[model samples]
Target: MVKHIWDSDRAAKLPKGVEELVYRSNLIGSDRTVCNWGGGNTSMKTTEKDFRGREIEVMWVKGSGSDLATMKTHNFTGLKLDDIRPLIKRDQMPDEEMVDYLSHCMIDSKHPRPSIETLLHAFLPYKHVDHTHPDAIISICCADNGKQIAEDIYGNRFVWVPYVRPGFTLSKMIAEGVANNPHAELVLMEKHGLVTWGETSETCYQKTISIIQEAEQYVNDRINQHEVFGGKRYQPLPEDKRKQILAGIMPVIRGAVSEEKKMILSYDDHDDVLEFVNSVQAPALSQIGAACPDHLVHTKRVPLYIDWNPETQDVHKLADLIKSGVETFTSEYQAYFTRNQQDGDQIFESAPRVILIPGIGMVNTGKSYAMSKVSGALYRRAIAVMKGATALGQFVSLHENESYHVEYWPLELYKLTLAPPEAEFSRKVALITGGAGGIG
Candidate 1:
């Protein structure tokens, strides 16, 4: 894994905080291995005078969907430090309410929502903070004995934090750990990622790169040339046949998942998809849950798997299989919802947003084309993460119970409600019998 640190010669001209942070952010963000798109968050805590001219400590944290690699000053949300302290001390706060608390603290009324991890960055007693779900680090973090491995490797150099859903409680847990071991420079959140902070932004960024490098070394030394990788990398439907294949099958999936409006479908036919589908362990490992915590919203839990062989299966036969797979997926989703839903919540659409067809490629559906693409990207990353995890050991992720909690989290559901309701398709359907071949 390559680590890109700030380079004075290459730095772009901008305000100090924004320039330095953005420079540092892109250095890592540019490398998907360290932080893929918006998967990580960064911050700097500094004192800025309020409108009354009295200086107040405030945190500038990465905002929602802000790609660190391409971030600007406006991409961060600035919140008063004092406002965050009260939140940290609270024993509990619902995730959605926590979002409200963060929004309430934003110094600028127009700032987009801060990251869900805003509190986490604010509560830590450090001038600068950086968190990333580096694939190498995550490979180790997700191990069954991940914490033990972390401890054996870093000892007192880093504080090993067990997996906790990222929220106010997680921030509190991290704060307590830091207090107990004041000298620690890094904290590893098992099955999540790494958090490093320092008195300077450069320090935090550098430390993050260094620690992840160490993790890379550890994994390389252990899994070196294990011949653990074995699979025939298959190509998706020939490029020429791709359009025909999708046209034949996507309608069935869209109709199955759509309640009142159309659901957009995304198909993947990249070489990597073929490799994962044809892999020896495809059956055992692809069933795991979303690649990362935030991915739960974009990709949902596990994807529906449709077993097919392009060499032998005809297009018509494959369409029927895809339809059957979606039906089973929706039914399973219904059962899952029935078993886990709280009294007030209702069941969601039966559509399997993420689909894996062995002979084709990965598929995803969303309310819109953009969202479908986002899910597609996340699923591709999921494939990479899963491949890495299985090579090391059996792949396991947040339990089905955890997936349920996140999938149904009020905040995530709230996002869906923000989109305009699907247009009424009922108005478009017609009997059409009398005008045409007619049996009115």
Candidate 2:
């Protein structure tokens, strides 16, 4: 369980502690086990002076793709609450148009757009609000008996919310849930995560910590009682040890997973990565949708898992097996897109971003090294929650259609088109003599 790191002595000197909120946001967002990179959002409701020196209500929400660990006040956009509040009553809006409207609501259009969850934070009647996708909360939220489990642990303190598609739909559901139980301490979104609020930043942050601690303990107790043999953290092989596993096998898998662009591989064998690769259910659970809806944009709906054990598998024949596996994964992904894609859905690259090896651990691939790392990190985060959820009950991930919708979300898909193309290096050569012959 993670503890709240707040310093009152220092907070007294800062202006409104917006800086303190930024500090807390980084603490929560940076913890991979708590919330993967950019997987969650946080906000604070406060008064700010506009250009005319007029006092105006403003809510600052984390910007898209901003890593909370390093986020500054500039990374959060302050939207005029007066403009945002009106959105609560507007019955329906397209996701893309809604994002446009949110951008328009910004007090400073120059600032990055506020999160889609901006409205959810604005709807709540609190001074400080923090939202996260902690694995401990996930264990309870995604359990087979999620509601009852939450009620058993939280009683009347939390209001259990059923899963609804995120964005305005979720914001609306939250609005209703809040109105129904004004005194509720927390809100548990089934198949999602937890939400908590308070008058002060410390209260809200501490409450979040306490909730997760209880849930973590609950899962651990259940595992011990049933003798379920909770998962272990696998030791990563050293660089020398990894040479045989990845050296000769990478080109084969990378080349096979391509059409026009070659794939770059990111390898890891950390505890989280190993937990998934070594799990009894890696093949079954890794194929289920993303850990959270927010992860779809980064990790895709599923990771491609290949069954190769470096310790005993035949090294010479590894290339053949990998080629077949990549082909199978590609065909299956294309079929998934064809069957599930809507009329206006744009086609995406069919290659897998993440891959799992039996003894070698996991490898995530991308067009670039950084993207491959992000892909691997997210899948590893997803698997952590799945492992924790198993201890409580049968782990449940998002449904197939739900996963498809999020991965192809119109507003989200539009953002993909906006990314700058990767920089290219052109060929330039100079004739040079061998070391023995070259002279100035």
Global Cα lDDT for candidate 2: 0.75
In candidate 2, which residue ranges exceed 4 Å CA deviation?
224-242, 309-312, 414-420, 426-440
Q: In terms of TM-score, which candidate is strongest?
A: 2
Local accuracy by lDDT, each model: 0.75, 0.75
Query: Positional deviation of 305 in candidate 2, in angstroms?
Result: 1.6
**Per-residue C-alpha lDDT of model 2 across residues 343-431, encoded as one tens digit per residue:** 98866778888877766777787777777898888877677677667777777778888888878877556545545766673111235
Model 1's lDDT to the true fold? 0.75
Give a tens-digit lDDT track for model 1, residues 1-440.
65646665565464656557767777777877787655789988888988899999888888776777788888888898898887766789988788877778988978768877887888788888998888777776667667667776788877777778878888888888888895687888866778888787667777888888887777766655554336553445676686777777777767766753457777777776777776666766667666677677777787887777777888888878877887788788888888888878776666777887766677788777777887887777777666556556655688887888878877556545645666655213335556664454
Q: Which clashing pairs does model 2 show? A: none
C-alpha RMSD by candidate, in order:
5.7, 3.7
Location of the lowest summed lDDT over 10 successive residues in candidate 1? 424-433
Extract clashing residue pairs from model 1: none
